[model samples]
Target: MKAKLITLAVVVVALGGGIALASASSEPGSGPPAIGVVRAVRSGTDIVLPFDAYRHTPAEINVIERATAVLARDCLNRFGLHWAPPTVDAVDTSRPTAAGRYGIVDAAEVARLGYHAAEPPDRPSQPQPPLDVLMVYTGKGASDVGGQPVPEGGCLGEARRRLEEGLPAAMPGERFAELDRELYLTAQADERVQRAMTGWRECMAESGLRYADVWAANDDVRWSAPEPTPEEIATAKADLACRTRSGLAGTWLAVETAYQQRVISERRKEFDALATALHARLAHARQIVNR
Candidate 1:
């Protein structure tokens, strides 16, 4: 029997509202001045996880999926069966997607897609192979066919093993969650961030969208409707406009960054260890993809 291959998707959402002042480039002598003691510790490198390394970039995800798919295809082909590879896209990590970020900044997007994420592009369907073939691919035990025992760990497992060799078994986001929490707490307590929040609230009130804060605006009952109503759309647009007018986003980002730098300085040793581990993992991932 062929094994049924299970594909896992890893999603990472960045927390905190800091502006990244340092150059993201690993190279020295590039971009703006490094921020504070954190920069001193790592030189020019950014302390936070790089967008590509946060979870898996679309490309990295595709590589792993393609590797497994190829293994499945080859295994099935041996028995005169056919299989198809999975399609993937690199994740977009450029901007924050948190509900509190600008309180639905993209008005046009909200009007078009509402609160839901855009539907992924559909792919052509492929033929399913026989149960035995699936069992072998999935690593589920089944009686040997053609007097050959199924490969240990199935082809899918073997493919994953190869792609993930030397990588941490746990998801990277989990490890970074602690850092994110600390940064978030610091931002909440920051007087500058609080001032920005107050200004944002006043701006919203001017637009007749009275809300306590971004969180209140986001959690408004009007948005709970099955589809976005006209009022919801209008409020969302006004919310974003007010946020911009108040310069809340920029202020929050700057304050968050400052707080994060402080935290990084205090936790220098821990962050340094994390940075080293992440660098090694990323290098290993690049090797796998290139090979």
Candidate 2:
């Protein structure tokens, strides 16, 4: 039996929102401005950027989850209810998924997976807390379970507050996430990047695939098959070829990196301060989990 890969479907949703950035290069292949290190063409599975430093690693995310469980458990204990950790959406503003950010740069990956995220096995389902416990946890019903008072928004909200205490005015997030979200939009709107996409589209058309853009090609309903289809594989291969041939990958990366440099330089102090606060919060979370 062949092993199946999970698609996660998050790639398209993450790439949907974008806005134009200030004008730059006539040449899409121009190198990013000399502000920070520019990375080589990378696989969709290997995307790492300057702002990634601020994003939580898998381990760090684990620590955060554990600490939240502990704190929520403390609140639930007051009401004589047990709290099993539920997987909450990312409270920390980590950078969004980067899989389709540049519109499919990895040929081998697309050929094998076809615009799907190369994620691990499906996660085990989290244990659900009882309805009474949830009412207190989410603050949806009564203020208190039995007699113990529930914190504002219940335990989850309290845990979030505890985690975010002492951070800057920006609650729950920092500047890096804000900039990362904007950078992609900016790059997408760039003239050079747009020209490169035109080239990519033309290449796809020649291969008998009609797509308005890279995302359109990736979102074609046919790829929604339970597994990669012959057509999907062929189209993915052509997409990769077209990206390289049209300079889409190079141009987008350059434009995005340049924007990152300008923003990081301009907000170095604020970014640095936010980073320090984040590390400090993680340290506290570590202590909570250690207990």
Q: TM-score for all predictions?
A: 0.59, 0.77
Top-TM-score structure, candidate number: 2
Per-residue accuracy of model 2 over 15-90 as CA lDDT, tens digit each: 1112333233333433444433434465644455555555555456667767877898887778888866656433
**Cα distance off (Å), candidate 1, residue 111:** 5.9
What does candidate 1's lDDT look like per residue over 1-291, in tens digits?
110111113433222223232312332322222333222111101223222234444444445455556656677676565666554433433322242232344545656534433344565655665676688777786646566666667766666555445643332444455445545555555666677788879988887777787767666666676667777667766766776676665555555566555545544554554455455545654554455
For candidate 2, report its TM-score.
0.77
lDDT, residue 8, model 2: 22
RMSD of each: 10.5, 6.7
**Candidate 1 local distance difference test against the native:** 0.51
- Model 2, CA-based lDDT: 0.63
